[model samples]
Target: MKKLKILILLLTAAISVSAQGFEHFVTAKGNQLMDGDEPMRFFSWNIPNLNYVEDEMEFGRTNPYDLPTEFEMRDAFETVKRMGGTVIRIYTIPVRNTDFPEDAVTFVEAPGEFNEEAFKVNDMMLALANEYEIRIIFSLLNNWPWMGGRPNYAAFRGKDKDEFWTDKQLIKDFKKTVEFTVNRTNTITGVKYKDDKSILCWETGNELESPYSWTKEIAAYVKRLDKNHLFMDGFFAIDGRTTVMRESLADPNIDIVSSHHYEPNPIKMMKHIDNNLRVVKGQKPYIVGEFGFASTKGMEAVMQKIMAEKDIVGGLTWSIRYHHRDGGFYHHSEPLGNGIYKSFHYPGFHSGLVYDEKDFLDMYRRYAFEIRGMEAGVDEAPNAPKLLEIVESHDIRWQGSAGASGYHVQRSESAEGPWEVIGYNVSDAAIQTFANFHDESAELGKSYYYQVLATNQGGESEPSNVVGPVVYEYQALVDNWVNYGKAFDSKDIELVTGDDRSFKEITSRAKGKKGSEMLYHVEGELVGFKVYAFEENPDTSSLKIEISGDGERWNEADTQTEVYASKEKNYAYQVPKFYQVSEGENIRYIRISFQDVAQIARVELLYK
Candidate 1:
């Protein structure tokens, strides 16, 4: 009886450990990544906004830099899982730049100071990574000024950009960042980041253009601090430098060697990959850290080369952006090679047809499974979407599901009962910065509850949380730049149409110079007006709205607008401004003058 009791206790302890601990940590074994006994290979994506964001250019939002919410982090992981991706590389941890706004949030506030709130955001991401069974490669810094990096560090000490590679104080400051990140404990899961298995490796930086001395120093420091995770050499411009690459592979501290390939020609890209592979074939694992923006066939050819080469571990596409917690997917327009390809969303959409987005995504999904020697099958149903807000009978927005391609909106008289489908196969990606579906057939006098179901190739999700009892009262004169002269007229303004590549709508911009104006004629009494405007540089651009009973005379309307700015050069950040009319006032015409270069996306005139 005592022996039996001992066996029972031992079994219980084993079960407890199994339940609490992760299965395995990814380890390096002679040019291959191993997950326990099996080799690990992945065809994944670079999720730049995983830890920090540079592309939160949404409508009505002033600040672009934001910490990812739990909903957003989960959506990213879930999307990776559905894509059959086992790994993702997050962009660098951000540092403060002198050019940023004083109120901007970043991970490293000063040399030794850190932002706890930003680190908490990373904590949630690591927790969700473990839950979703996906691995992460955490890049430590950036080479460019998009987010602060070596130059910023140099600026901190009043040194030149190249001095970052040689200056002792600048290097020490960078090491402080590394040590803080590696030694910190996750606040949510009670696991120290150094000991967590979710991290696949620690990259020195994103495309660092440093000398061998700096690379060797940083690699040694990272390996000394964290023994569990592997180290990757994040050198920039991998243009067939086999001798330099061979030397990097020989370093004991550097466990992985990677290259970023943006070559448009598939033949040249393959040659470069082959040369790099030959240098590190049996010494260490090699990966194409970032690759894409080629023709569909060109990209396919490059992916095929990676799969054919046994020594090459895997490749991560340039990037993939996910749905925002607010409503729509985060977007970034790559301003290279004709500036056509934007960041890709899952399951593809019609707006991205110029880049063969749907076909390329389909090919990626197939190759993701093929590289693992598994057959691509049906995916699971997406999680239920969240109905965000209902402005009126026509304007309804919702937070989109991760892998969902389209949505089904249903309506009913009561909150709980039989529902009728009002929208079928409505795409959330059709609209940019927000996911919306219009109820064109809603009765004028009826108040009804509404719910949404997300759908894809797999299946349909359960109904979303009910939102409603919205009554159609006032008819809003909504002009999404489509009805230009019907309800509004403009002076020195040009209606820009066609594939703008950012939003699926028309826009009107100043033609020659500043002081271009738009005049809207309202039929009935005006309650208020909401205007969506885009400014490349909000610091230099201004929009003034005025009201008038007669076209000749005008008075400045009392307006409420948010202050907007961005560090991005030539990025058209968007924000909405609202102007309320005084009660019992005879207001019929509204005039808006644009200062500097500004574009208007939409205007809604509410009337009684």
Candidate 2:
């Protein structure tokens, strides 16, 4: 069996190399991707929803703000360029969910049925990518059924989801989708799909949990269709990624080894990098197809190691958020924090939002240059300090972290203001006193907002927790809020103080479920609520609003009463909707969720 495998590999290698006849092609030399002789090491990320459309289907999972526009693609590619990225991974197939058949707007509606309208989405994507001079790693299939995945295809063939991994009939049917996509013409650009230089490679699937032999079959099949591009396995580096990569690389059809890393422990992330380096040392060219942070811990360390390794081609972050998308500001992958902005699938290209974005962009820019064998970049991003105390209208105090070289302060008169830096190097002892920075400019008669950010060589971290137009003495306090009950974790309501329900506040976007109501206790009576919200799909979602006192029971008059949102409240909305609680009725607790998928932009409780 071993001898037969070796014999097959040799023949496959000869065929793949000779079949290449394109202007730009990517081939793997040991531990390096070379374009003929010029090495290709990339800094990249994934836009799983690149060829996406809001056809009222959840084929591509969306957020409150979805980037389903063609210009959004332009904005995304521009962002990639700005971040110093040259390549990106995009999902070519929109896996259909069996549960929502109406939402099945995929390349293949049924087996062998090519949807031209749907496939045109890919045409536009490639055209846009070509314009940007950015390359794509198109993921052809998915392991999960969220997007009409392997199971959807298998079920269409009258087989179980598990059958997709081993059944020949199922595999053959999947290959049809591959053959169709690999050969389809890009009508928009007047170019053949297989001839497009925008495509870097075709991944077998996204995070497949199938057998090693199955990946070999698909990888081999994709190679026969398009020899111009390399192939990769979607095997996540969790249990036996190293071993599976070795096994997959043995097939000459498989040109690159792709691994995923999401370890939060700095030590584990560091170790993962070392092992990835060791595994691909003399064997195959490797790239971390995906690595990300749900939070800020250990991410810098992980990035530092990935960038430092010479053998590793480069790493791609989990995703890039596009403009005007469904999810609000960022993906809800982890607890939303300063640097923990879903590791960079930013929601939109809209400017003026105070995301410590420069620091994030700087990190990628530096590493992108690093992979190209070029020396570039300045300071690593510093850690943001925690705001400890607000001494009324006078001094603002905070605590610094190890990574930050200094801290900068900005004060605003309103939530949306022309902010000015009040202090710099506040955390740097040599430059100024650490932690305690006096706001000499604070005026007692007017309200003032402040933002504190930590800075280092790479850039500045996200603003501190106490970003404020902080209310001074009983100016309707919005402090003390928590996630009472919800399907997903949301930010504290106190993070939202201003009337502007923009994307910056962590509490802006919250989720609700069918028949599940969320609870929250505010410091004051809820005279009214300004729930800036919208349905993911108005047709599928509905609103249910109710309030309570002490969070246990409903208003004194009615326990089951609900204030259904008016027609105008379905999509774009304004602030608080007041409810007459009848004199002395409890209005301290706000209970709101939905009958289906929904987004709470900014939950504001009006104190009487």
> Candidate 2 — worst ten consecutive residues by lDDT sum?
57-66
Q: Local distance difference test, per candidate? A: 0.78, 0.59
Candidate 2: which stretches are off by over 4 Å?
Answer: 1-23, 53-67, 239-243, 294-297, 325-358, 373-506, 509-608
lDDT by residue for model 1 (1-608), tens: 99999998898656433433358888999989999999998899999898887766565455567888888888888888888898989988888888766667898888988999999988888888888888899999898766678888888888998999999999999999999999998887767788888889999888888888899999999989998999998888464543235568878999998988777778988888877766676688888898888898999899888998888899999788888776767766776645667788888887678888888888898889889998768777889999976758647888889889889999998999589999997877666654366676676678889999999888999999998778777656666664355447887877664335333222232332487888888777787777766554435436788888777788888776654444333244343433344432777888888766666667777665
What does candidate 2's lDDT look like per residue over 1-608, in tens digits?
99999998888656433333334767777868877688887777777666763222111122222225565576577657656678889754864445543433556677788778778778888888877878888888877664457878888878888888888888888888899999987777666677777788888878787788888888877877787888887775652344336687677888787777666556776676677666666577778787765233355566667667767788787666543322112223223233334334321211212433435555566677766676555535745556655645433566543345467888888767677898876532211111145565454456777777877656889887756656553212221122334222232222222322222222334445566455556564544454444443433334555666666676533322223322221123222222222323456666665566554543434443
All candidates: CA RMSD (Å): 4.4, 13.7
lDDT of 1: 0.78
Per-model TM values vs. the true structure: 0.87, 0.60
The candidate that achieves the highest TM-score relative to the unseen native structure: 1
lDDT of 1 at 214: 91
**TM-score for candidate 1, residues paired by index:** 0.87
